[model samples]
Target: MTPMQLDLNLLAALDALLEEGSVAGAADRLHVTAPAMSRSLGRIRRSTGDQILVRTGRTMTPTPYAIAVRAQVHALLQQVQGVLAPSHELDLTTLERTFTLRWHDSLVALGGAALLAAVREQAPGVRLRFIAESSTDSPGLRRGEVDLEANANPPAAADVRAEKVAETAQVVVVRPGHRLAGEPAQPMTAEQYAAADHVAVSRRGNLSGTIDDALARLGLARRVVATAPSEATALEFVRDSDLVVTAPQATTRRASADLGLVVLPLPLDLPPASVYLSWHQRYDTDRAHAWLRELARTALDAPNRRA
Candidate 1:
């Protein structure tokens, strides 16, 4: 790899310029003179080998290159702030900032209530928003659109930081009084599970998944009659219908109240899956972020006993 040399000041200037899309606007945002901003922009253009922003008619337009690199610029800025502004301690009691987080609806049962309550109790000013589970989280986090991801089997990359937040097993769910609902005296058997029509949660519209794999290894299989984007939607589909839905215990717990469903341990045995909290490594030591991660761990693992 070619050795790289970059000035932190230049990166800051690039961040402002990319955000505002104009030298003058960047200068204003940075509280510097327009001429000074133009000079910094010139440096950026030379370093990047592209006119990061070009004047288009009455407005300054960011080139595709600028758009592509803006998120990196923002991340670099965040790192710089963390480094120079680092302290031995953090004051979250008075910290007021909105925190963006990504999670799926299924976790609502197990982690949601605790996560929200913990945030309120500790960092009262910190709020969260959920990202669609089916969407890729890296680009969104790197772009600063999402701060962290609550997910499973998170990507293992140099820039990614993931912490095991919870552990859960998938279980079969059906409405009360169904034929199979009361079929087993204990856990349902593999053959019995295979006979039920399942509603699958898949992003690619495929109707079968890991449950099939587990069953297949045991020489069994399930008949899938439906596919859905989320467990909530799947449970809703099977609410009053005769179809069965298998999902994370969290999902069954959350949807049970509204859907009036019963949770059954999957007849087939499988490893308990770990749910993780992930973020860019750049934020691993961030004070606010640290608080968020800590709270997430406590919230998610408290009831599950998976910490």
Candidate 2:
């Protein structure tokens, strides 16, 4: 085929038609009418001298040639998009965009105000929508529904990019008059800590965690009286009742003070929480997205700030 005679538009239409196997579906995918798609199919057929799609018993099927070239066409389209995509040079001051950030409730309760302030001071036109994460394996980032996700551990998907924003240790917390708090100077033994009614915080609503595993190694088990979906809720439960909960030392420090609760070192040893900022690989080169990721890192990394 000659380059001058080949219309890129026709190539796109052909690819869509071959993939959809229906002119109406292809039209919907390309945001055009069925009649327009039919006309484009005709042009593609005339230029390529191949009936890209052949009608068979009220359904369309790709011809042998069409099937052979489908992969090549898709790869070519991706190359074209990459070449035509905008560059990484951004003017944040005047950039007007709404970025959706999905994070755990504790992160929002801890760092939402600081992040919003930082974004506002730098880009007045930018808007940040903070949404609660429903699960650890959420596909929001890969689906383009969420621009960024902040969590202690990054998603396991290979297509997602993650960067460590901060780290924090876990601390045990309880109400002021709880048995564990009466003797502030004396550290509770593992058995004494395990004997108390505990409130577990998990996004999946499980009653066990790394703490329980550690306790199991020592042949001890704590009674989990309740399970809260978020750390903020768990803290509230701990504040109003005798149940104890473990949470990030830095973020929960502020909440603990606000709730008038006592913070103590965790009886069970666990690794420090590594906070991360994650996004899909598709956004790796996007200018606005790159800046937003940097802004989040800066906000969370600020002195005395918790991730």
Q: Give the range of the ten consecutive residues with the poorest summed lDDT in model 1.
A: 134-143
TM-score of each: 0.78, 0.75
Model 1: per-residue Cα lDDT over 1-307, one tens digit each: 1116666788889998887778887898789999998988887788778999889898999999988988778977987787798476777788878777777656655677888888888777777776566543346565455787776677666677777877787777888887777756556678878988888987567776677898899888788988987877888888878888877775466567667788888777787767888787777767888888888788777766642
**Model 1 CA lDDT for position 269:** 74
Q: Which one wins on lDDT?
A: 2
What is candidate 2's TM-score against the reference?
A: 0.75
Model 1 — TM-score against the truth?
0.78
Find the 10 residues in a row with the least total lDDT in model 2.
298-307
Candidate 2 clashes between residue pairs 3 or more apart in a chain or in different chains? none
Query: Which pairs clash in the backbone of model 1?
Result: none
Error at 178, model 2, angstroms: 0.9
Q: Native-vs-model 1 lDDT? A: 0.77
For TM-score, the strongest prediction is 1
